[model samples]
Target: MIDINSWPLYVQLAFGLGPFVIGFSGGGILVFTTLRHYDRIVSSFPNSRGVQNVLRIFANYGFHPRSMQVAAIAGIVLFPRMCIRRGELEPEEVRNFPPEIKRLMVIFTTLLGVGLAWVALAVVLLKLSGGN
Candidate 1:
């Protein structure tokens, strides 16, 4: 792998800062746009229990204002099969979910995944390069 430390200052700044701006913009879409459709998400899977519990717990604890949003995202992303197995969402329901919502989730997930991988790669590169 190429050593990022050896790269010019501008290249290193772009490599490190580009994803930060992109990630936040994508997250803003999720918070402002995607979250507007949250009722649609709940209505699609009215049997949701686990996700509700997560929301409730966050509420009870008085977590961040967007904690429920984050939890719902986590439920959908992290424990999808568990949600299905627990009857929070049925197979048919999942299959019939709105295409736009799925697209949004896919975009959010892909961005988040790629951002994390990029950061991890940077960490490894810096470690290998014997950090400046």
Candidate 2:
């Protein structure tokens, strides 16, 4: 068997932590964007009891706001697109999404992007910082 220890430190770090970092960061972005989108829709339809109830249901699932946001997003991403495509949400509901939610989505996406970028940076830093 080849000796992994003989490989460069940067390579080792990248091989070791890259998958976890990328998976976590990408998932985070997807989750944050989904939650923020749903939040905006719920906020716009303040009179809609169903929307309000859905939002509350989402909130009860976790301690961190991020966790709720992520779970909402994962549902959107993983569920059948056809289900949402059917006129479940009104046009006004889509149009009335809050500006803050969009801004937060951008922020969350940026943070995840930065996190993915860091995977490489971390490998280089670890190598320079001296592991092999």
Candidate 3:
């Protein structure tokens, strides 16, 4: 272990907060993009349970912007296969997906993975240090 306890206070603070910062920033951008592009995306994933449920929830919420954003991010990121894979997502739709949406998906997934990994590392560091 790298002995995170021995690190400077500022450095420790940075490590503690970095994942949250990335999660919030990336989440905000992803939500906004999803909000802006929901129409373009919804049609493509008609059979995806995650997408359908989220959209239903988003609709039942009276089309609230924040709800829609949360729905889109959760729908797309959590069940990526529902939107990307051949059996889960329609082949034609996947093939015809817009470039911008693809880029957004990549960015969203990467940000989520990075944020989770960062938090996992922090936990592992602490565990290895015997909660010191």
Estimate TM-scores for all models.
0.74, 0.42, 0.70
lDDT of 3 by residue, 1-132 (tens): 567789999999999999988877677667766667767777766665555666666565344654455446544654566456534445555556677777776776677679899999999998887775
Q: Could you tell me which residue pairs clash in candidate 2?
A: none
Q: Is candidate 2 or candidate 3 better by TM-score?
A: 3
Q: Pick the candidate with the highest lDDT.
A: 3
lDDT of 1 by residue, 9-117 (tens): 9999998986776677567656753446766765676556655665555564333434455537544744479778777656676676787777777776667667777
Worst 10 residues of 2 by lDDT: 74-83
lDDT of 2 at 75: 35
Ranking by lDDT: 3, 1, 2
Give per-residue lDDT, candidate 2, residue 81.
47
Please identify model 2 stretches exceeding 4 Å from their true place.
1-7, 23-41, 45-66, 73-84, 103-132
Q: Write down the worst ten-residue block by lDDT for model 3.
A: 61-70
